[model samples]
Target: MEAETVSKKWEGKVSAGLPIPTTAAQVWPFLEDFCNLHKWLPSVDTCYQVDGISGQPGMIRYCAATITASSTSSGRDETMIKWAKEKLLTIDPIKRCLSYEVLDNNVGLKSYVATMIVLPIDGDGIHGCKIEWSFVSDPIEGWRLEDWVSFLEPSLQSMAKNIQDALLLL
Candidate 1:
């Protein structure tokens, strides 16, 4: 009989971001639903929330098929171990600033605490939103800050933009 085989391999990280035209509340649902991760994120081949229970912390969110900006490292898998925290951190709707961790494989760390600020920008006829995700991640993964951004930002930012686009259809 053949023996069962499993492996746990951890690599470095990358991060990036893009601007969008939706408020945080409008984008929050898409971010909260772990199953919908693939819809917005470009590189995620698979993802699921570990604790499906509502309002559960340490609810795991994992992913795969994340690669490098150079387009190197084919088949490089990435994961985001996540939890949902509400009001645990700073979330002032009037201020449009919040701070919390979205977990790994975000920014190539086992954990990433992103302090994202959502500022409302005025256009000619509408109030748009500007999002800035700046965070500090664990350095244990042997990945540089630049590398962390590379591993993370593309898909996340992609989803953010997609969410904005979807909202426009409504």
Candidate 2:
């Protein structure tokens, strides 16, 4: 099938409340494992090391994080790329907070920032986690604003659902 290129400046987040019987520190590892992205991200088919570092600056990896309504002429699949530019700005394990950025050249983002904040919700003592996602990016050459949102919105929504579901199951 022919591939329709997708380029966009997107900034969005997909997070849900994870049930914790213990401390927020306990679940931090699962959230931080970069290679374990597919476990939390439903759209992700597989993730592998391409080159450079991972979960750090100048890290290179390929992620098959694509989905399609049907497996037909037009579909989405992760491209085997050189690298994903996600430089960790800050990672507060105790607070369950992380900040990252990706540039256009490496990951193809004119400008982008993604922050994940995890905090306790209700004092049920059972431990409730809250994740807040934020981002912004410049559109790519073949990518447009409208299509970008259209492409990412559903993915983000599903991502949130998958994360929540994972928590439920695990």
Candidate 3:
């Protein structure tokens, strides 16, 4: 009998950073609350805690994205909802970093883990911050590595813009 083999290679990995015209202190608060993703992430229609306490390791959040789909047969638009449950793996307030992994998702992502960090930056004496987001995952069906980057880059940019806009209003 021949022994079976398993491949342990990561199929997709991506990293992106967005600079916000604000301090890390301002940005960290928005990210620290695990259940508030809908506030800053444009694609998230709603996010809420499903298990455990917010901002703590082991906390799980259910995030949903609702989209309008064209129904050619009915000649109308229909609403579709996709969701993911993500669990907080680690959080370090002092370091301004957190990590999470997807527990369940309607999306095709598998073995997905992500980390987010807020770093302080100074540009010509303007106090600002940069948010670094990176992830690794098993290959998603019908998705290329470039597809992941394409999705993440714009999402992060929009998130940064939303957060900055909110902070400016405060």
Candidate No. with top TM-score: 3
State in Å the error of residue 137, model 2.
Answer: 2.1
Q: How close is candidate 3 to the true structure, as a TM-score?
A: 0.85
Candidate 2: residue pairs that collide: 7-143, 104-109
* Candidate 2: tens digits of C-alpha lDDT, residues 56-163: 544544555443345455565434433443555666666777776663334456677777665565644366565556667766557665666566556555655566
Candidate 3 per-residue C-alpha lDDT over 1-170 given as tens digits, one digit per residue, 9 for 90 to 100: 87756534344333333454577877899999889999999999999998998789999999999989899999999998999999999999988899999999988878999998888765331557777888878767787777877888888888988888888899
lDDT of 1 by residue, 30-85 (tens): 55454555687766566655543433434444555544343246655554433332
Stronger candidate by lDDT (1 vs 2): 2
Per-candidate RMSD vs. true structure?
Answer: 10.5, 7.9, 3.1
Most accurate candidate by lDDT: 3
- Output the TM-score of candidate 2: 0.57
Better of 2 and 3 by TM-score: 3
Q: Model 1 reaches what TM-score against the true structure?
A: 0.52
Backbone clash tally (model 3): 0
The lDDT, on a scale of 0 to 1, for candidate 1 is: 0.52
